[model samples]
Target chain A: MKYTILFGARSYEHEISIVSAVVLKDILKERIQYFIFIDSKGDFYLIPQDKMNAKTFSTGGYEKYPKLQMTKGGFLQKSFLKEQFLGVEVMLNLIHGSEGEEGIISSLCEFYHIPYIGPRIEASVMSFSKELTKLYAQSRGVKMLPYHILDKQTRNIDSIPFEFPFIVKPLHLGSSIGIQIIRDKKEMNYNLDVAFEFDNKVLIEPFIGGIKEYNLAGCKVKKQGEEHWIFSMIEEPKKGELLDFNKKYLDFSRTEKTTQAEIDTKWTERMQMAFKALYHHCFEGALIRCDFFIHKDAIYLNEINPIPGSLAHYLFSDSFVSVLDALAQRLPIAHSPQVRYLFLSEIQYAKGK
Target chain B: MKYTILFGARSYEHEISIVSAVVLKDILKERIQYFIFIDSKGDFYLIPQDKMNAKTFSTGGYEKYPKLQMTKGGFLQKSFLKEQFLGVEVMLNLIHGSEGEEGIISSLCEFYHIPYIGPRIEASVMSFSKELTKLYAQSRGVKMLPYHILDKQTRNIDSIPFEFPFIVKPLHLGSSIGIQIIRDKKEMNYNLDVAFEFDNKVLIEPFIGGIKEYNLAGCKVKKQGEEHWIFSMIEEPKKGELLDFNKKYLDFSRTEKTTQAEIDTKWTERMQMAFKALYHHCFEGALIRCDFFIHKDAIYLNEINPIPGSLAHYLFSDSFVSVLDALAQRLPIAHSPQVRYLFLSEIQYAKGK
Candidate 1:
């Protein structure tokens, strides 16, 4: 079956997506017939080897090349996109922000009636928006910092209810882009300017002080031949100040201390409950990495990466589920003949008499 | 500036979109330059007249249309899209339901860096999802019907803690599609099946015994080159049995009984406050139609349509504001020189070395 790995979108995390797709290609090589790559520039290519080289075609630039382009009048140039998947069975999505996480691909998959693994469009959109996610999380009793939203038209910054030392970021951005820790009113103006550059809406939250951060990566893998799914291990960053983007991604040369942390059984259980609630609330599937800050023995959810980096393979230790097993377990069933028939019928009916 | 009118999508309200785009074309003909039409089959065409003519496009059938061809590597062609919106400046979206209302187009607009007139992506998605909208409305003290979400994997439908005589619908569908009023277990099975067809998630709400429907159409209009915006008139649908899809759209032939109803001025004041709260909460602009049912003199919000049918132009009557004037007020502001420079600089930075 032909396998496609969609990556590198028009988002701040586009590079991260490329890195993720490369890593995933290595892991899924033998399991799938062929891997197709899509990059941030709206290009599609094929991964020739373990180390995929990005290239450009007349249609677009892609790593693992695919011949397809959405043309001027909304016409599908069949010759370009109708490549038999060479038994291509599934799409491994490595897109991070924007259209990737917010359900564009999901809707396209639905429209094309293809089986893709990830959160449905609704959940992805809700989770992608910090305001929406915070609202849902707060309603579900998930711990979050008290925050207020400010629009571009907002005139009086003095009226902001939150106290100083607040953190501000674009309401709909990821990868900590446009994040600013405003220490006073002097910095507020500068920070707001930076935040507004990324988006029209800005979110200001009172900074949570003095808390250790942890990355809990897990795949909601349905047990082999079973209906039940289980959460994987929890990885704690070496105790220190918050790791910025550079430390997290670019500074990989430095052996940043990360180890499996010892969590209290009760705390682990609570985290599991929160994770499950989030999974159900967001209707997310496959791998997810949830970040949380521990303050006074209580865990506060920072954010969720529906399409986590490296497919969060590192989190699944040798003892637990492997990447291959996790992928196999989470792979969605292709559209049944009955479902396909219904879709075709709807399309025909829509054509009108 | 080039202008494109994006209409006709994979929605149940595809025909309604065509009607909307045609009407909008008639109104904006003198105001804008060029108008490109997007048909229901996802093909683009030019609407020669200011009215929709099914005979012109429908005669050829969707598949036989000039643009209907699959590409080589399986991606839709882009030449057709470019030709359709060659000189388009802004997209006046008339698409309704699911992908349209759920933020796919908005996201694409953002990706392409094109300006559009409607609710932004996040708000659109939230407003359409019944469970999320209800939760948000409840949070804002907006009275709403009590409803519970029934997930697909859940067992024991009887365990849901809700009263009988419930109305069930797909969580994120619009136009009253797949909506069913179930009175007992015998009906529950059938309604659930119907709802599940539209979406994987379903919302069940206890039917509000007494129903008096009202349609409040208002737009945030700039008052004569001023910075402040004002809301337009609020029109109440003539009180009667709930208007179904057939009565609302299909039977426009019937004389519309909707007239501005007399009510205490205080009601208008309160409703305005509610509308403003929602506008700020969702960061919405342009026209919005708020549906409400008064039970025991208490207004309970059913839902909000960011892009209501006919742009809810009927509600603007009696008010000094005309639909054309209201639309003119929303014309996109060309970026200031400084702002444009900043935008270009940021894009260059994003382009990276």
Candidate 2:
């Protein structure tokens, strides 16, 4: 079975994606058939496994590699008289931020009929937008902190129903890129201006000081003939006003060093139940980490990381390869809605009405 | 501007998409630079303008044309020693169902930085799924008919809170392909089975008998730095138990003959306001048709047609070419989140953490 690792797209988290892919290369080892890197210009390049390192991409040394063209199902390397098929039985989406979490790679995989290991387009859209995530959580009966949206078009601050000490986040960004904590009225305008630089919409939520935040990663996998959820032990992340961009960067770059959070059995069960409610039907195939805030003995969903950095390998107990293998075998088959063209066939035979 | 019309992907509404593209070809005439037809196999073929007819695609005659490759930004034709760029400045999404409304083509356009005249990925995802659309409507404070979802995995009918006389619809399908009106409890199982054949999930809503249904189409256009909504005259479609697959197919095939619905000004303003709420920031730059049900003087959003058949040309009075040109000029510029790789560069220089 051939597996392709796709990473490094035109995103703010391009370097992080490279780090994730590099970490994955060490984990997946010889199972990977191709390391397809998408440059900032959105061109595909086939990087040799031996040359897979941070320097190769950072120094733009990947330009010398064979360029690949995206065809119907998979990529093709155009050379001399024939095009070479970089056979990909399954693809692992390791890109982060915009192109990855926001549904570009998912769309590419779906359009080309390539089975991939990541959030589907619908899940990506539902999870990527901080604004939409709140709606989805509400619909699922998953509790979320009350929030207000400030649009760049209107820039209306009066619409906020809550008091001061708010957390301002760019609506569609990941990796804590454009997040600021506004302690009072004097800090609101400056924080909003910073968030508007990254996205048109900003999500302002009540900043609960020293909130209990837990990160749990899991995925629905099929074994034998039945499907069920495989959940990871929850980790209590160190929190501040928020983990700033640099801290989040270092956190995402860490590989395989994980410690489970110590919590009561009842609380763990309750949090897991909330995760199930959010993950069940919408986020079927993707491996995701849901960050939750335990507020006043009630669980509140902070956000959904559709494409978690390094695929959240450290969270789960089993080896990433085995989990990925089982998932790849039972990857959701896209139902090809059979088109008989019965209507068109009948129209061709009939005369003008 | 080099305008491209992309249509027909492995969708149930493939023929309807062809009909829509043909109608568009006639309307746009010489303004169309290329008509890229995607066959059921998800392959791209450049169909000649003269040969653009129902018979051409039905008889599989399009296979003879030069095949095109989907590159980063646009399509390319490879022959001899060189690849010719198709030169697409803007593209019009004409595909109808799965591939189009499901966010595949939108993702392709977005990833490649091709300015297109259709719904963005977030809008497509919100509108494509009936269940998600309900959540989105609720989030926007738009009224929707109460509904329940039936999943294929659980096949749970016991969870439906609604009584009989329910309308069962496949969650992800357009064109009214697998919709059934259940008048009594006995018809529930059969109707649900039929709807499940089209999609994994089915939405059951109370069938409002003879509901005052109206179709409204519109888009947001920017002119001289001012952005405003351009709404078309509301349309009152002929109602039935439901327009089953055949009637709906015929309706979608019609072109350029429309009548302004004799709706009262107050009702018109209300419906237009609802349309504005649904379309404002979420569905910017795309021309869409929203079908609404007016019951008890309250407008309930039925569903959103992200990529309407015939581009809903008849709904709007203006020529689609001019509307498309205006939209193309002001198509939302995807904010490219800049990455300096300052952290990664620092990591390369640092000896130890």
Candidate 3:
């Protein structure tokens, strides 16, 4: 019953992850047995029992803690540490943005055969990418705003594709970090410059007028040994225009207006329909936070957060811990059985040679 | 001026990778200083200088070769080896399929800051997934066949979107490892069972009759410090009625009818048009191999091999060494600069707290 809560990584949302960790620590305090923090530069830190606090996580100068490298084994390794095993049974991944959310960390977990509590590598990677997510949504005939990709080499700000009054964002960043709404031509350069600082590639999406933003969180639970996904009541964040970094982390409690439990059945049905449609096209991870923009009859899948903050804890019943515990009980459910190569065999090599 | 030719990993195409290494050895033998082979189980073996022949590669029992692990410093480390530093400046990545081409090893290279000679992690991952690749193509108006995804949990062989005469393939495997043509409903279960052996998710694409198969190899080189992509003269493989695993590797040399230097500008223009369009989206890395199907006026992107066989050596010049040298000189061309933070600053954190 060992649990290691992993948080913090090299992302624009580094401190936000720490905040998410603080929230997680509060909810799953009795459950978590160990803590690991990844620095902005991608260094692993094992927090000692005495140093485990919200302040310690926020500050993140864990020079005294043991630095780790993930081997084929699931547990943390310090190359030459006196103690070899840390007895990590399940990894509670609270990593937010960039490396952590973008499937790199999840892939690392997969390569190491660790049971991580989020989307699989492919899902994480696809969800983290705005371009890929939009494309998948588009293929599935999901409503989406017109978007254009501007690469550093071929296309740049000098050659903008969309008209002004467009939203430009870094292709892979989360929590609306490098995002700007260009109202006019003059604001284009500055917005593009700011966006490029986060990612070399930026996605220019046409801004729709009279749009309402709604966030719906989804979770997968096992019922009668079969996977059943549950959707939460939709929340409309009061944050102006866009849910920027400030609105996401700071003064976050008043961020969204959400119902406590069972809302209108029709509303729930529509939300589930949207969620299920996006899920087939690759909106994934164990706990998923999908945002949509509704303008009259049109509903566009705005984006998906694979590693949603505190695993989108507030959306579940009572707290995120309730759903997390349910999901955690089915640990390593996603783990593929031993790969039996259909065409690959050692004896076949001898014959082929 | 150290060059280590790396090949073999846990893929159904493991033996095929060894054959590809043989092809690479013929082309890059003069420049290659060391050779490393990764067995199917992901064990690293430092191939002894003497035991570097095709016979050795085709039959992999390198138990005596020193085991190696990629360190954070971007060099191979063996805990028991006499020499700690391998002095690996540039890596020639030849490992095929799953672990090799799917960004796991590429990310390992990225994490270590090693100059891997292939598509970077993002491009590799995107190209590795058939569903994503097709979706991206669909987004850009790059014509593709009608396809549906069948997940392990949701859909079974009984439920297929495409009508009879469809192709069932493992979504992520390469070299036609788990692929079958389901000509009728009777064969659907068998094909799906076969496809699922290689991957949990399978892509069901409408099989096009009387379609021409073409292989186009693309290379990226630096001239006057400016990036230029070079395309190979098109080849029409003779491997009829689905290029199966045996046809792809064993009798591969005789499969293609490729014009050596120049032919058909109009045709090349059309092929290059498709290649360049895909490139603009994600046709990345030092080298890329894209397969296409053209039936009537319709052209569809079939699949992309991030690390094509022989490094797609044959498609380039008389030898791959020429382009490898040109690309190696521009070591680490894919590195990016600038990391903008939306929030999560230490000074800002202190103030917020």
Best by DockQ: 2
**CA displacement after TM-score superposition, residue A127 of candidate 3 (Å):** 1.9
Candidate 3: tens digits of C-alpha lDDT, residues A27-137: 667788778887756667787755655556544457667887666645545454243656566787777776677666776666666776777666776777888787667
User: What interface root-mean-square deviation (Å) does model 2 yield?
Assistant: 1.4
Sort order, TM-score high to low:
2, 3, 1
- Tell me the tens digit of each residue's lDDT in model 2 across B249-353: 878877756888898999999988899999988898689999999998799999999999888888876655677777778888887766566766677778452
Give TM per candidate: 0.77, 0.97, 0.88
TM-score between candidate 3 and the true structure: 0.88
Interface Cα RMSD in Å, per prediction: 9.5, 1.4, 5.0
State residue B316's C-alpha deviation in candidate 1, in Å.
Answer: 3.3
What shift in Å separates residue A152 of candidate 3 from its native position after superposition? 4.6
The TM-scores of chain A alone, one per candidate, are 0.80, 0.96, 0.86
lDDT of 1 by residue, B76-194 (tens): 22453232224344566667776578776665555444566666666677787888788778767788877777886673597667778888878877767778888888888877888
TM-score of 2: 0.97
Per-residue alpha-carbon lDDT of candidate 2 for residues A24-124, written as tens digits (9 for 90 to 100):
88778899989999998888999999988877876788999999977656888988888898667799999899999888899999888888889998899
Instruction: Report residue B115 deviation for candidate 2 (angstroms).
Output: 1.6
Rank ordering of all candidates by lDDT, starting from the highest: 2, 3, 1
Candidate 3: which pairs clash? A119-A285
Better of 2 and 3 by lDDT: 2
- CA shift at B67, candidate 3, in angstroms? 1.8
Cα deviation at B285, candidate 3, in Å, is 1.9
